[model samples]
Target: MLELKNINKAFGEKKVIQNLDLTIPDGTILAIVGPSGGGKTTLLRTLAGLETVDSGTFLLDGKAFDPTNTKEQEQVVGVVFQDFQLFPHLSVLENITLAPKMVLKESVQVAEEKAKKLAGQLDIESLLNQYPYQLSGGQKQRLAIARAMAMDPKVLAYDEPTSALDPALRQQVEQLILNLKAQGVTQIVVTHDLTFAETIANQLLKVEPK
Candidate 1:
């Protein structure tokens, strides 16, 4: 569903994402691993259309990313930001369904139904009535994943998803990844968790030092 070729980016004199090439087909979970500051997160940002690449071609579902032509690219990519960008004021269910209801114009009933179902599937239904502040790190991450999935994105991307969790919580998140892989959620994730990499990803890519 996504393809990138000859991607190049730099900050001042330092270069990142040099001549990078990647293709992610539908329903494939791809894990991208790299050392710190090796541009893994930058790569994710580029795919999410959050960072501009100096030179590259990025295509999502056959339509390339064009800043001047945004309609074609927007909403085709769903990103779970590294910081878990949840709305502090909204409850979990509200946060998850906001885009579907406001952006997609689904009815509140429909959106809430979908959100609650997804939350239950992700084992976070009990937390839906609560706010993000009431949840733990893993719960927050799960909430983010639920929100992303609620939008019915063509492709999903995550950054350092479980990097800050404890070992037990990390395992729980790892299992969640495997569940997504099982359910055919096409994903690109920047992760340091090698265990999740070995288990869930159909392909593993390591970003080598430039």
Candidate 2:
């Protein structure tokens, strides 16, 4: 389970999140949806350890942890950005293996093995040698997911996953999320698509600006 307690964040003057509390059970998909300036992405960034909260407690599976500790959060939370930020200079295999080899200090062979497995699961094994520019939009999305999954995080969070996809591709992402849940991965999605959210999310959180 993942729990956020009394979370608060703000810019210089305007508060984005205020006294927010949420709980998500293991293997559940929770979608964060709201208006444009309602701080949905801010909340997601805080969960991903990319933003610091003024006050909050993060409880993962009943154990409390520091949200500002980026290194520790990297192992526990993986994020797929809105743009599918694949490194343009790296091949698919390189993109997926880089973090594990660098941050986790895994052997090259081990990282390659893990990357290959994730690629196969995402049906991108044959494109391992291809660069990001060579991939289609849907393929790039899967590669982004594979890269995050390579870290073996307990929680996977996506920011606007379907923003650039067509209807068919959107359905693919929905199923992909469900498949991950079946494998016991907890997920949080930040999206503006209410239809998409209702289709995949086990729980929905509607945030309003403070």
Candidate 3:
């Protein structure tokens, strides 16, 4: 379980989130939705440990979390950014294995094996030798998902997942997310596509900027 208590965040004098509270059970598919500039991305960033909270408490599985501790936090959550953020120069396999090999201290052979498994699961096995520039939008997104899953995080978050895809590709991404849920991977998605949100989210949270 993940719990937020009296969360508050601000930039200079402008507050983004204030006195907010939430709870997410494990194996949940949550959608964070609201108007633009309502701190939806900020919340996700905070959860991903990319941002510092001014005042708040995050509890994961009944234990308090230190968002400032990047190493420890990295093990808890993984994020897929709006732009996909694939390394332009690295091959798909390299991109997927980088973190596990470097951060997790997994051997090259082990990392490559896990990357292959995840790529196969995501249907990107054929693109392992290809660079990000060589893939289509849907393929790039699938590669991104494989990269994130390489970490084996407890929670996976997506930022504007379908922003770069057409309707058909968006449907593919939607089904991919559902499949992840069926595999017991906890997912949190931030998207403006209400129809897509309704399609996969087990819980919908509206983050309103105060």
Candidate 4:
């Protein structure tokens, strides 16, 4: 189980999350939903160690989970940011392979092969040599999803995944996410599409502004 105890986060004078507690079992799909600025993204960022929490304890399977512990965290969770934060300088393949090669220390061949598989799954294989700036919004979002999947994380978190896609593309991505459940991957998704949330999430969490 993954548990958050009395989590609190603040930026300057603005407090985002406070006294928040949540528990997620392995292989569960969770969706965090709420109004804008209600700390949905903040919570995801805190979990991904991209934001600092004022006070909180994240316990994974009864053990303390330090957000600052990057080495161990890499194996535990992968996040798809709202902005699709891709590397501007790297090609599509490089962006997908960088972490696996550097963090997991896999060989170039191994990383490239994994990237190729993900690119095919994401239907972006033809654009492997293109940079982030060259891809369209939907393509960039797909790239972000592929990049996260390349890490082979136990937990995957997506922030407003369908916001950048058209109706058809959104449906495609939604189905792709649903497929992850069978792969034994726990997902935490934040999406404005209520129907999409209903279809993909086993549990829903509403984040109210504090």
Candidate 5:
């Protein structure tokens, strides 16, 4: 389980998150939905360790930890950004293996094996040699997902996962998330699409600008 208690964040004099509390049970999906500039992305970034909270307690599976520490949080949470930020110069295989080889310090053989497995699971194995520029938006999204999953995090978070997809591709992503849930991966999704949230999320949180 993931829990945040009395979380607070600010920038200069502007408060973005204020005394927010959230709980996400293990292997479940939670969707954060709200209007633009409503602090939804702010909360997601806090969880992803991209931004630090002014005050809060972060708990994962009953263990307390510092959320602001990027290295610590990276071990537990993985994020896929809205832009599907793949390295333009790297092939799909390299993109997925880079972090594990660099951060985890795994042997190249081990990292490649894991990346290939994730590619197979995400249905991008055939495109391993392709660069990010060669991929369609949907394929790029899947590659981004594969890259994050290679980290083997306890919680996976996505920002605006369906923002670029058509209806059919949206359904595919919905099903893919459900499949991940079945595999015991906890997930948090930040999206503006209420219909998409209703279709995939076990819990919903609506944030409004304060």
Candidate 6:
């Protein structure tokens, strides 16, 4: 569902990613593992259109989504981050529905229903009325996953989804990811957690930092 060829990225003079080529098929999970500073997160950012690529292109379902057209790229991607970027003031449901309501122009009813369904899928349904400050690390991460899945994205990008969680909670999140794959979600996870990767990754890519 996604393709990258000759992808390169830099932060001013520092080269973070170079000569990366990967093809991630639909309904499969790809794990990216490497030492710290290996450009793993940079690769995810480039694919998510948060960082501009220096060369090559980002393709979703064979359609080119380049640096010039971010709007088109936004429509097809959903992401979960290690930090669980949930809004502090919004309830869990609001945080989950924000993008769909704003970007997709979906009605409040439609957005709420989608968010609630996702919350149920992630087993966070009971906490929909809670806010970020009220959730534990694991609960917040599940909420973030619910938010991402509420978009019903064709592809999901995770930037070390459980890196911040403690081991016990990390297992909970890992099982959720496995369940997602079983339910037909295509995922790309940027992580060094070899145990989690081994459990779910259909393909593995190792990035070398320069």
Candidate 6 structure quality by residue, lDDT tens digits, 24-74:
888899999887899998887776667788898778888887634557426
- Model 1 per-residue lDDT tens digits across residues 42-150: 8877766677989989787887765334553256667898899999999999999888988788899999999989999999999889999999888899999999888
Tens-place lDDT digits, model 3, residues 83-145: 888889899999999988888999999999999999999999998999999999899899998
Winner by lDDT between candidate 2 and candidate 1 = 2
Pairs clashing in candidate 1?
Answer: none
Candidate 2, 23-90: lDDT as tens digits: 99989999999778899988878887788899889998898877567474257778899898889999
Per-prediction TM-score: 0.91, 0.96, 0.96, 0.89, 0.96, 0.93
Which runs of model 6 end up more than 4 angstroms from their true locations?
Answer: 72-74
Whole-model alpha-carbon lDDT for candidate 2: 0.90
CA RMSD, predictions in order: 2.0, 1.3, 1.4, 2.0, 1.3, 1.7
- The local lDDT score (0 to 100) that residue 74 gets in candidate 4 is 58
Each candidate's clash count: 0, 0, 0, 0, 0, 0
Which pairs, if any, clash in model 5? none
Model 5, range 149-180, lDDT digits (tens) per residue?
99888899999999989999999999999999
Candidates' C-alpha lDDT: 0.84, 0.90, 0.89, 0.86, 0.90, 0.83
The window of 10 residues in a row where model 5 has the poorest summed lDDT is 65-74
Model 1 TM-score, 2 decimals: 0.91
Model 3, TM vs. native:
0.96
